[model samples]
Target: MSDLYIGLMSGTSLDGVDGVLVDFSSVQPRVLSHATQGFDDRFRAELLQLNTSGPDELHRAALAANELARVYALVVKRLLETTGTQPAQVRAVGAHGQTVRHRPQQFDGTGYTLQLNQPGLLAELCGMDVVADFRSRDVAAGGQGAPLVPPFHQALFGQLPGVTAVLNIGGISNLSLLNASGAGSLIGFDCGPGNALMDAWSQTHTRQAFDAEGRWAAAGTVHAGLLQSLLSEPFLALPAPKSTGRDLFNGPWLQAHLQSFAHVSAQDVQATLTELTAQACADSLLKQAPDCKRLIVCGGGALNTHLMSRLRALLPGCDVASSAVHGLPPLQVEATAFAWLARQCLERQTGSVQSVTGARGARILGAIYPA
Candidate 1:
């Protein structure tokens, strides 16, 4: 009686689309198959531009959403093929569409978060029910409408006796501190830049998408003064139960901080960005979960060797390791969490934690589409 769900995620990184097939019957959802499809450079550029452009940007967003829907359909088809699961056998697909504009609070007092996913079109194309629009409900409930993975973390890895910090380093980084009582109490927030700064710096310098295992960063020295300046960002000091995305950690932010550092070596900047992520993450964890001895790292940043080494240096007493060490692959954890959220949607269960998202109370997240 296991249900198969396809969870599609396009994160803050705007790198690509990750579609995961998961089986939800037991405590831990089983990942059946996964596929990642990279977005074309043209689409990426358009997306980046739309993030800051004016009302005319809506046209670009529409184009991007159409393109993304096609990619989602393709990924769903490939996932079904790879898993040997027919479309009829699958319950539904959870589509976390591309987040174009997430203005949780507007100057006009209208709070809205936009995740540009044409779920109806996706459902029509994929021939399956699509659950999307997951963030609006939480915002309506007076929540931050982000860092929605903590409840999933609790479901997947909350067995330890003491506080455990689950750090997810996607384009943005967020941490969830799970109290040891096994009562599912948690606190979470976006720590500052993760791979976003490093990736932007690398691309600006070497035309590379990323540092690749943080090799380029490992070759350089961390600029301590620059790192401190980066750390001084107001967002880093923001209290918990908060969240952020590329809106805060994009190229312009980096450039503003660059100042005279434009003369610095690209490698040095890369190293400093790496250190920034590690330090910001560790600082957040230490402040919130001072007694936490176990830090579980997940997402793309977990694979960055240089970043991991820096994190290990910053948190000397904590046992820092990838979620893979605890049975979850770094790259697939977020996708899998979305799959779990899909399961929650199906069961009419709450997928968000009030303690994490500042929601008034727990509520079932996402709008469902019948197959």
Candidate 2:
């Protein structure tokens, strides 16, 4: 018996969607096929707009959702066509729609997070079961509704006989600590800005999407004063069960930090931002899981060469490397996670454990829309 699922992820970067066709036939799941589809500049702009305030947002967002589904369907079509798989053969598709807003910390009773998606529309378009909205249930249960990948990380990398921490550095960074000692529960939390600040700065000055290989950052010296001020942000000191997105660390936020360092060159600001991500991650590990010497780094940041060097330098004696060294590439890890999540939902299994997200207990996450 073979259980196949396709995972679609539109991460906080808003650059594109990653789709993977996975086969769960043996103990170790196999990647049958995978592909990426970048959003057109116009579509990307609209998505960025929805991330913040805009007029006629209701109508614009609806149109964007439809376009998103259409684009996702294209990715799915390619994944299946290339792999010779079919929607009927696959059990489901796990789609993580773009997160326009995430404010799980607002416990004043009016807090809500939004990931723009039309799962039902997706199901209809793909003719396959779709599992989406994996965050809300955790929020409803008094959890941060993020870093949801920790449980999935546990499933993938937990067997290693030590404190194995998987670091995901997407738009924001998060740590998933798999303690093979003591209770053996997985601990997860956001570590703060990952590539967001650097990416924004790079786009502003170089007109590049991101600082490829961290070259620009490496060319400049770190502005210690600016780095210190950025490090002072209170969110970095918060306890676990926290999550953040562009909502907190957007362009305006970075501009405010840069306003204080008027004389610093753009490259220095970029370098400092890179240092900020590395330092923040190191701080989290040293503070929480000092024994975690083995880290599996993933997401867009892992590909940044200089950032990897910074991480290795800041955290002495720790073995730092991309997820590729551990059976999955940096980009494939998250999309594959949702594929596992979809399979879990189908089996009525608990998708997340309490320790990871501060939920009440292990609960089945996400809603299923049948084709």
RMSD of every candidate to native, in Å, equals 1.5, 1.2
Which stretches of model 1 miss by more than 4 angstroms? 180-182
Best of the candidates, TM-score: 2
Q: Residue pairs in steric clash, candidate 2? A: none
lDDT of each: 0.85, 0.89
Worst 10 residues of 2 by lDDT: 104-113
Error of 2 at 365 (Å): 0.8
lDDT of 2 by residue, 1-371 (tens): 45999999988887899999998887887898989999887898899889998999989998898889988999999999998886799999999898998987486753778988988888988999999998888888877788889988988888888889899999899999887445477889999999887887898899998999999999999999999999998999989778888988888887787788899998999999999999999999888888777989999999999999999998886899999999999999999999999899889998887787777777888899989
Off by over 4 Å in 2: 105-107, 180-183
The residue-level lDDT of candidate 1 at 104 comes to 67
* Candidate 1, poorest ten consecutive residues by summed lDDT: 101-110
Q: Given candidate 2, what's the lDDT at residue 246?
A: 91
